[model samples]
Target: MENKKELRNWLNKMELAHPLVIAGPCSAETEEQVLNIAHQLKDTDATVLRAGIWKPRTRPGNFEGVGALGLKWLQRAKNETGMLITTEVASPTHVDLAQKHDVDIFWIGARTTVSPFIVQEIAEALRGTDKPVLIKNPVNPDLALWLGAVERFYEAGVSNLGVIHRGFSTYEKTRYRNNPEWQIPIDLQNRFPDLPLILDPSHIAGRRDIIFDLCQTALDLNYDGLMIETHNDPDNAWSDAAQQITPETLDQITVDLRIRKEEGDAVEFRNKLATLRTKIDVVDHKLLEILGKRMKISDEIGKLKKDNNVAILQTRRWNEILGKMILEGEEQNLSEEFVLRIYKAIHQESINHQKKVISN
Candidate 1:
């Protein structure tokens, strides 16, 4: 594995004053469409132009990209617009073809990242290359699998690595099409601090209106860049129409988003932040202490239950606790979702404690 300093060479080489922007249509609909968007984006902050050539769709007969023909379109767009071109590569054939077409960057889609066999194959195909390969997080929110994909590339001697947080697949319907489990990428950031992290708000929002907000949030979280799907006409785009935005809208968005400084400029601000963080540390310590005491109480309750041969899980009690805590959380300015998540984990831990005692 490349050390931290060696891993960050690509980013250092860019020396961009602003975040790197990668923008283009989701899929190359036509030569005209690709070139049109590319022309519009070339003037904007986007340094890299992207178009999906071989889209991995969930089902068949659903317009699975224009194939190799799209690569020529992307190449032509790059030439005309003077922008770096990128495309998603799924198989070894895709890799070989992308290299032939002089694709500047390669991105491993979420679907391809899921399978070790495919990732390894593509990694080996891209072995010892200096191109910045951006790997999207797997379809599911598995950090291990995502890191595994990065590992495969590193093992293949590909060092110019980065990641795209395109969100993840989930059954629950929410505002987002793909749930932006932000913590998963944050965890990856914790492990590989040098890896350039980019946000694909286009996939996460699945709507044009919320793209700017997502982009702003990403910048606030110290994301290195964004990969937004831009088309000449978003509503009538070939694929992922809901998520795609127009080139004009993208231009406005790039202008509107703010890039905050990582560190406070003033000594006053630094002192205030340090004091606040110290308070947080104290509160965190107290929270742990209280949770430890609660667990000890749970242990006593488990012993009592064991003597009477009582079941560990009391669904009625859990529901009551959940309902009550949710109401309390709302009073304390916490969301119901946050309360439910916290309480559910506590309830599970309590159940485990009881199970251990009862089994003994």
Candidate 2:
């Protein structure tokens, strides 16, 4: 990964406003569709026009992009609108074709980012090119894998790099199409302070109604920009229609989003914030100590279970504990969702401890 200074230099070269927006359809259905949407997004906050030329859908028999032909449409759109063009590249061939079409930027989709071999191949293809490359986080919330992909690109002499947090897939039903495990990206930002971290709100939201709110949250979290899926007629779009929005709606979202300052400039505000942060530090330390003690007790229970030849996962007992905790958490002003996530993690750790004891 590039250092903060090097990443800052990359950002400076882009010369973008505070939140650089990249907007276009999820897929390039046709030349007219691509060009029309590009025209609509021309005056918006969007600086880059993006469309998927080679979409890798989960299921077969879907409107997988317009193939290499779409690159020409993207080129035409760029010529007409004067907007930089970007697209998802899954292979070395994609990189070659995109370079041939003079595509301004390239991003690796979540599916492609998960595979080291594919990333390496694409990185090899882009070895000498200085075009900006944005890598989406893997389908699963694996930070190490995501970081590895970025490092692979960086090692391959790709200096102009960025990351896209498109959220992570989960089997459980959620309000979101993918769970916006915001902490993963926030942790990434903490690790690489200068890395350009963009959020894909359309994918996270899965519905137009919540896109604006998701974009606002991302900006509030100090995200570098947003990549919203835009289309002329989203309701009848080829794929991911529910998540795509019209360019007019994209304009409104960008206009209404309030970008926040990274930190307060006032001395009093800084001093007060530091004091509050110290208090939080103390509370967090205490919380960790308590969790450590709980885990130690869990280890003891694991030993006892092993001695008694009892299974580690007592489903009935776990259900009872979860039920009790949810009610008690409500009294303590904690949401059931929050309590469940915490306990689920703790229970997994307890199971791991039991497994170790049983193995021994």
In candidate 1, which residue pairs clash?
A: none
Superposed on all Cα atoms, the candidates' RMSDs to the truth, in angstroms, are 9.7, 9.6
* Model 2, span 1-360: residue lDDT tens: 554345456546776556779999999998999999999998888889999999999999988888999999999999998889999999999998999999998999999999999999999999966778899999999999999999999999988888999999988777889988776887798798778888999888898899988887676566778899999999999999999999888888887887655465685565446545644554575477678778878889989988898888999999999999999999999999999999999999888877887788
Deviating ranges (above 4 Å) for candidate 1? 1-17, 262-360
TM-score of each: 0.75, 0.75
Q: In model 2, which range of ten residues has the least summed lDDT?
A: 274-283
| Shift of residue 214 alpha carbon in model 1, Å | 1.0
Locate the minimum summed-lDDT window of 10 residues in model 1: 1-10
Per model, state how many residue pairs clash.
0, 0
Clashes of 2: 0
